[model samples]
Target: MSASDSSPELSSEIALLRQPGLIGCLAGRNLSAFSSQVQAVAVGWQIYALTHSAAALGFAGLAQFLPMLLLTLPAGHVADQFNRRRIVITCQVIEASAACLMAIASWQHWIGAWALYVLVALFGACRAFEMPAQQTFLPAIVPVSLFPRAAALSSSLFQVACIAGPSLGGVLYGFGADTCYALCAIGFAISALATSSIRLRFPARQRQPITLESVMGGIAFLRRQRPMFGAISLDLFAVLLGGATALLPLYAEDILHAGPVALGFLRAGPAMGAVLMAGIMTRWPIRHNAGRTMFFSVAVFGVATIVFGLSHSILVSILALMVLGAADVVSVMVRGALVQLGTPDEMRGRVSAVNMLFIGSSNQLGEFESGMMAAWMGAVPAVVIGGVGTLIVTVLWMRLFPGLRDLDRLDDIKPAD
Candidate 1:
């Protein structure tokens, strides 16, 4: 049945899933994320096994972050000026090639920690272009009225991949690193093909002259949109301070006395929670007090981080991580809806690029920070301290961004002028 012909009782999610383009986008996105997660597990295990240093993991994150920092802005402009779908396809192909190279290096017994870092940097470069372009896919494919539900459902599926990828990678790694890398290559290739199949509803874009001002347009836009700025920055600091996912390897092996499989489960824990929460949000989205809900969620994330940091039991650690993940998805959904619906279609790429930068900083840089702190003190102390910092940021941000704090509903956000 046609979407408009469907019964009024039909769920928004069911209608969204019926869209062929969104299906393709979700498939491609899930495959890409799954492959990346698998790569992460293998890289983390292999690097630590080779160097046995916490600092080495931090350096790994740094390797990825640097490329993103350098390329993301220009990449954003490219997304706005070029075919976003083509950009996504091309990036996936490049990533696939890099994964193949890594696999070959591993199989040849010539792969070193440095080689892995370089390949990871290559992956980072591709993602710099891929993300901004990819972010625009939903709004282009679906009506604005259906966007919030679409976003939640998309995140839910992505989290499912995140959960599966690490577990599969951990298992595959036991066979060999080459095997994991080979699978990652295949995943990226399929992702490229899947993305190529998408029919974008809005394919036209206005090309702007390259100037310093245009390049910095996203940053300027965010500055004026206090709610968007606050939500994005709040996430940046909260994740940067509270993240302990980077330390999972240490926790699984040293603290929990578990093996690679257990490590996989540990990695999947948060995704499990995230997917669950995303499902909940999809069915019953936050209708009121979105700003306050976001703040509360972040605070819960901080508390969960603290609990995970102090936990020695595997079950407890996983539970804490799940809570952390669940809390995080709430903030993610709220922020995603706020940013996407509030920004003009023309500026979506640039703004999403800025958003990607914040996310990359929080994740990659946070990993670096966790590693350094773990090296200086201990993993537990570093994680605990970071959690406390997250709490402080949460409180501070509530006071600082009252505009965001007072926000009542996602629908209340209007496109920036």
Candidate 2:
């Protein structure tokens, strides 16, 4: 078969890569990911410095995710209702502007823990709008056949930024917190500018008056799909329980006695593993029983998390985290590609939005769980327990949803007209 006729394979991906706007969009996403990690590392450092409390660090993590919970559905609605490119660009601007404000606050030494939390809340609000818009917009840029490759490519680039950003943030923090914040601002600004240059034709949806009913329809649809709910909820529960990320600042400060540069390495460890995994996925797409693959990957992730939690040495922790990251990347790739393929074009935004809720909950609620648990049991113990808990959840999910594991193809789940 000629390349175009091949199932969403690498050659098909090459065709999409030849398109005009994709590179620019990819570049924008890279910069955006960089800025986000920088912001996170800086904030984590600042909170830890001020409070010397792991719980506080967890709360800082929570602040960023809380708004995602509130705005994700509405944001998804707006993405579906309007121009996705425009929505993405607007979100980029908002995020960049927020970064600028944060930089100024840092320069002036005006930021407190509470103020930082508030700023992160605002960042999260922008994120809710940004993610769905971007996710839905990709199919417009590339053919549906190339989505797996596109997903892998996007995942790889994002992981690269993630790998670099944290290490850079840590080094910059050693020089000055303000410098890290400034870098974040610059990253965001570049992302905003790059996003502006991309253009695409978006599919139109019939206008429906905004109401709770309208939003709930999407929720109800997702609720009825066992694989969709299982995939999303498994991620939510596993990550929330196994979230050792929120405790990194504490580990850097108290246990490892690492400086900012070391902190960056600590943060980048997972991304490095994820980058490697993403690159492999690019070459070899998950072809059969991808849901089962995701489950196994997450199980490995939980085990790695447990190892990370128990390790006191930086080297061991980094190794454990790298493994966790690798595992998580596998799961993320399968789940992301599946969701994109499974959801209808018209319902993509809403379904993506529902997915975002799980993403936010897994990430943010995990932070909260980590923080509260750290408060009660101490950071080390909390992370350790959370990791074990993630393993348990993974096993339970496997037993509870056999169909999820048997999911063989995205084309199998298309909604009937």
Name the top lDDT candidate: 1
Which tens-of-lDDT digit does each residue in 1-417 have in candidate 1?
A: 887787653667677777769889999999999999999999999998899888898889889999999989888888888889999999999999889988899999999999988988998899999999999898778887787788889999999998999999999999989999999999999999999999875556567888888889899999999989999999999999999978888888899999888989999999999999999888777889999999999999999999999999999999999999999999998899888889998899999999999999999999999999999999999999999999999999999999999989786677889
Model 1 regions more than 4 Å off: 1-9, 201-206
Supply the TM-score for candidate 1.
Answer: 0.97
TM-score of 2: 0.95
Query: Lowest lDDT 10-mer window, candidate 2?
Result: 408-417
lDDT on C-alpha atoms for all candidate structures: 0.91, 0.83
In order of appearance, the predictions have TM-scores of 0.97, 0.95
Residue pairs with clashing backbones, model 1: none
Clashing pairs in 2: none
How accurate locally is residue 104 in candidate 1, as Cα lDDT from 0 to 100? Answer: 91
In angstroms, how far off is 301's CA in candidate 2?
A: 0.5
Please estimate how well model 2 matches the true structure, expressed as its whole-model Cα lDDT. Answer: 0.83
